[model samples]
Target: MDTEMTSEGVAFAKQMLADDHAAEAMGIRLVRAGIGSATLAMAVTASMVNGHRMTHGGFVFALADTAFAVACNSYGRTTVASGGAITYLESTALGDELIAEAVERTRRGRSGVYDVTVRRGDDVVAEFRGNSREVRPRA
Candidate 1:
């Protein structure tokens, strides 16, 4: 695990999370972050449960997506997800503590690829892949 993170990257991630009302509302906490990696944790709440009594897939995807966003943007560049997909492998219920860990797979020029795994304890719940594009600053 290459955990070499620049000081600016850490500062930027902290500031980004501060301004992210959606992440804040979901109780997502930043476990750790590096240059191209980040880990986040969220508890499955009652509101996140679906009609089937399992945690909603959307909520799981959101958690993974947020982790992916933080990881891609940790390079001190303005990166946005061009596309993302998730595969849910297990079901979770309310009160489950879910952790999403993201790592950069590759980066070239203005594009990057990242993988995130959502887990409940030692059980893998979902896997997510995200494609990212760095936004150029307007001159």
Candidate 2:
């Protein structure tokens, strides 16, 4: 719904999509990307389950983290996560579609924070917070 990203920003996102083999391997799909926000979705597969037969927290975290990465880097600056954490609130089963929405919380100088909420339909499944730092290109 928000359309504030520049054409170059969109191109940058596409480039990321083309090169992100890890995310693609997990079946993560990009839904939308804006200046400081992004939405991605993935489905829980049998390989992604834990001993309890529920989706692994790491996989969910990966989904949210990918969204956070895309959102933070959507502005076209090469960025990397300084740190990140996730809190799981619900469990999902195989074939369940999960969506992660990342939004920029704040940006100061070369550092920024983002919040990613993972959901199963309308239910909240997990929450992620990521700290990012923009890395300058060499002169």
Candidate 3:
């Protein structure tokens, strides 16, 4: 959270993270957040490595997806991923610090698009595109 974020953004992020048990269990931390953007960080641990000794693609995707969720929901609306895809560009190993930065691309009515880039230091490891749909509360 940053000082520039709106009160709605802060509250939304806080509530979302609080209920995100998977992200918490995976050691994900919110780095910053704004109206239509968010950044999160996760560290690759032994359990995240695959048989080939590289970080599993699922873990990388999860990090990107979490960032996308936060970015899309920064408006204080409950936004969930309708669909998402990821392209793995590089391999990562244990002890690597992965940073996922998400940006909103467009929003039309209840549908929104977000892109998240997962990087290890200066190198990009994965790119994720997510489609979000805001869920309206029941009256």
Candidate 4:
């Protein structure tokens, strides 16, 4: 949690922020990034709402997944999610600023596990767990 990121980690995070068009399009912003952890945030917009007027689950999931991706790749090796799962605890309304915090749970060789907690203020919104594998450098 307090571990400082190495030079490689900083470079990797910068590359990711520059390349992540999907997250940028969703208005996701990098709140913090460090070794094996990352925090991201996005505001729920009217277009992100579902039929119930709550923010869509997919958007919440995407935010969590993005955080996971950032954390897992903080080591600087190209990594990709092997799988992930999420549970929704509460709904979010328009203008709600949602935050997702991801931390490394366990890592073995090329594989890693990350836990992401999504929150709207102090209210828990969702929980996500992602499994990742370090792949080769991107071409």
* lDDT of all predictions: 0.90, 0.90, 0.91, 0.91
Q: Please, what are the lDDT tens digits per residue for candidate 1 over residues 28-115?
A: 9888888888999999999999999999999999999999989998877788899999999999999999999999999999999999
lDDT of 1 at 30: 88
> What's every prediction's RMSD, in angstroms?
2.7, 2.3, 1.7, 2.3
CA shift at 40, candidate 2, in angstroms? 0.2
lDDT of 2 at 137: 53
lDDT of 2 by residue, 24-93 (tens): 9999988888888889999999999999999999999999999998898887888889999999999999
Residue 7 in model 3: lDDT? 68
Residues 33-138, candidate 3: write the lDDT tens digits.
Answer: 8888889999999999999999999999999999999899888888899999999999999999999999999999999999999999999999999999999855
How does residue 104 of candidate 3 score in lDDT? 96
Worst 10 residues of 2 by lDDT: 1-10
Model 3 misplaced stretches (Cα beyond 4 Å) = 1-4, 137-139
CA shift of 129, model 4, Å: 0.1
Residue 116 miss distance in model 1 (angstroms)? 0.1
Question: For model 4, what is the C-alpha lDDT against the true structure?
Answer: 0.91
Comparing 2 and 4 on lDDT, the stronger one? 4
Taking all chains together, the TM-score of candidate 1 against the true structure is: 0.93
